[model samples]
Every structure is written in structure tokens, then in C-alpha cells.
Target: MTIQEIVDKILAYHPDIGDRRTCDVIVGADPNRECTGILISIAPTVPIIRKAIEIGANFIFVHEPTFFSGYDDECEWLEGNDVYEEKLALLVDNGITVYRDHDHIHAHRPDGIFHYMMKHLGWLEYLKPQARGWEVVLPPTRLGDLIAHVKERMGLEHIRYIGDPDAIVS
Candidate 1:
């Protein structure tokens, strides 16, 4: 399928997006290009772009900005920057298309990121729905243990917390 078709499919999954302005957009390459393969990632780093090129994938759907700005599409300030120029050149030269799906993914039912995070952390069963946002209710455990569990489950090397490690949490 074409890049635009794939993007439309993704947007269709989030009907609530409506006509709202979103950060989700094609940040590089041609949307009309036929997709050889697809790569989904948290960000479009140099390594990620290289991987896409190596894998013969022309379409990259990312959860974050391609450029280092809040809005990935705006690059007037990044024109002379070496890193930005290099990254942009890599995308353009390699014909790699990048689409940022931040806002719509967050607007998804059950919230795409949170739902997947809870699932990956094995906390889906403990999820408690609230009026504003959801919460996870875990069994009483020491703060240290909870931190360790989160780090392991999320494959994070280290995390910073403000509370006493020995304090019990639920």
C-alpha cells in the first residue's frame, strides 16, 4: 500500500481525532510513494533511519518528532544546524518517508501509549479507570520493589524517584 493509505488507516482507527489540529503528519519523503516496508518507532533517530534504509523500508511511523522541535514539520530555525541538515539529507536522499503519529495515538480509545505500556508492564489487570485519567492499583509493596519491577518490565536501566525506597506503596 501507499504511505498515505497506511497513514489514513491509522487515523481512521482514531475517529475522535475529528478536525482537530494534530502533530501527526508526514515529516519526510513522498506520501504517494509505494511502501516497501514499514517501521514503527518512538523517534526517528539517525540509527532508525539507517535501519529503515538497510531494511528497504521507505515508510517510518514514529510516535515522536523527526526534527528536534515540538512541531516536527517546522524547520525554519533548524536550516543551518548540522545535525538537522544531516538528518534531513539522509531522509531525502534515501527516499525514506516519516510520519509522526503523536496526537492521534494519544487520542485513541483507552489511549494507545498508556494501554500498551500497562500491557507491557503487566499492570493491565490492576488498571483502575478514573473520571480524568486511569490509575494502576498494585498490591502493597515497598517503593524500592515497585521501582525495580518497573525498571525490569520497561527495560529501563535506571529511573529517578522522589520518595523513600523503603516506604510501602499500593
Candidate 2:
């Protein structure tokens, strides 16, 4: 199906009781809306947008705004206080329409992003308490080894740790 059609169907499935703005982050199609590929993601960050382009996904169906609003998606008096105006400009220049699916993905069976991500991590079951992220049954691992392993696995440039980096977690 086309992008517009998908967006409409997404809005029609808002599960929240008082959820009014289900279209908060619904972006758009390509310039001609004839994109060869589609990419669904949690947000339209500059990195993710660039990745979409690199992966040949001309259409980006994001769950969040391309530009950060500083506040929690409310572009009120804090409208122009975003630090991502440049990213917005890039989207326009690249003919990318970014929409938020914050509710759309979450409204999926269980967590959309979480479920999507879980597949890669090989997690069959998860203890997903609301507010808290996840508790997967992982093999025993050392903190340092796990941290280093993760850093290498994701190819991250830098990682920040808050807890005692040396202290081990069982």
C-alpha cells in the first residue's frame, strides 16, 4: 500500500482512551510518493534518516518528529527552541516527510520497537514492566565484558555509564 493509506490506517487504531493526536509524528512519502522502498523507525533522527537513505529506503515512516522540540513533542512556546532545525532543513532538502508514530508503534501487540529489537537480541520472553525498559533472561556476563562487547557489537563511538563502572552486577 501507499504511504498515505498506511498513515490513515495507523491513525484509525489509536488504543489509548483519550489519545486524540495519534497523528503527532506521521511523516510523508517521497517527492513523487513513488518510493521504491519504505523504512519504519522509532524516530527521524539525522543519523537514522541518513541510514534510511543509505539503505535505499526513500520513504521514511517515523514515530517521532524529525526535529526535536526540547519539550515532549509539544511545539508550543518552545516551538523554536529545538536543536534539530538543521535536521528539519535536511529532510526538506532531501524531500523527506517525517511523522511521529509514538502512539502507533506502542499501540501494537506488546511493544513494537521492543519486539522488533528483541528479535535481534534472541530474547524469547521479556519482563516488560511499564515505565521500566525490559528484563531479558540473559546469560551470565561480566559488566566490563558486557559493556565492551556491546560497544563493539553496535559499533558505537562512545558510551556513557552512570553506575559504578567497576562494580559488578549479578
Candidate 3:
């Protein structure tokens, strides 16, 4: 499919005509298109943007802002923001197409990201994935073992903590 076809598919999945100012359905490139290698990312950063170029990715689907912050704020476009500027420049210069799947991907019953994470972590059968998060049906295990398992499975350096590390989290 071409760019137009891809865009149509996306809209078909999530038909909400949202405000452009919101990042809900921002397309850094064209919407309707088919690309050779599509780049999927959770956020758009300088490295991620360049990585797309290095990989010769014609289509990019990013989860976060390439220029702005927050959910829907019109991105700050001033030149003072060096990092953001560089990222945008790469896209413009290379004619890369970028799309954010925030609104559409989450529309799936379990959300694409949830299923992706679940599958990657080998927890699909044990968890009900949702757009917001997930629920896991797990057998009994030691708290320390559980923590270590989660940390290793997620490859997380530091997970958010409401209390001390030694505090048992359920």
C-alpha cells in the first residue's frame, strides 16, 4: 500500500477526527503510504530520529513528540531548542514520514503496546492487556523473586517507586 492507503487504514482503525493541535494523531510525514521499513518507537528523540535515517526507514511511527511536549500543546518551534530542532531537521531533510499511533493503536481491545509488551515478556496468556495497562494471573512466588523477575523481564534500570526499594510491592 502507498502512503494514502496506510493513512486510510489508520483512520479506519481510529476514525476520530481530532484537533490537529493535539498530538493524538500527528503525522510528521504523510499519512497514506506504504514504506519499505517502518520504524516503531515509543518516543521521538534525536537518536531515534537519526536511527530511522541510518536504517533507511521511510516511514516512522513514534509514540511521543518530535518537536513538542505534553499531549496536545502546539510544539515550541523556536530555534533555541537545539535538540528538538535537530530532530525535526532530519525528518524534513530526509523526507521521512512520521506518525504517532497514540489514538489509533490504543483503540485495539488490548492496545497494541500492551500486546507487544506482553508477547515480548512471554506473559500474553497470563495477562489481559488493556490500553491503559494490564492485569496478570500469576502463580505464587517470593516477593524478592517477583521483583527480580519483573526487573529482568522488563529490562528496566529503575522502576518508579512509591516507597523504599525493600518495601514489598504487590
Name the best candidate (by TM-score).
1
Q: lDDT for model 2, on a 0 to 1 scale? A: 0.60
RMSD of 2: 4.8
Best by lDDT: 1
Error of 3 at 90 (Å): 1.5
| Per-residue lDDT over 3-85 for candidate 2, one digit per residue giving the tens place of the 0 to 100 score | 56665676677555374554465443344464556677766677887877687766677666665452234554544655555
From the highest TM-score down, the ranking of the candidates is 1, 3, 2
Q: Where's the lowest-lDDT run of ten residues in candidate 2?
A: 70-79
Model 2 residue 60 CA deviation (Å) reads 1.7
lDDT to native, each model = 0.87, 0.60, 0.66
The CA-based lDDT of model 1 is what?
A: 0.87
Better of 1 and 3 by lDDT: 1
List residue ranges in candidate 2 displaced over 4 A: 9-19, 27-32, 39-42, 46-58, 70-94, 125-133, 137-140, 162-167
TM-score of 2: 0.59
Candidate 1 residue lDDT tens string, 49-96: 999999999999899899887687778999999999999899989999
Model 3 per-residue lDDT tens digits across residues 1-170 = 66556656777876454555445554455545467577788876767778888998877777775566555236555557776666666776876777766756666667677778778777777764432467776666556666677789989876664545554544
TM-score of 1: 0.91
What ranking emerges by lDDT with the best candidate at the front? 1, 3, 2
lDDT for model 3, on a 0 to 1 scale?
A: 0.66
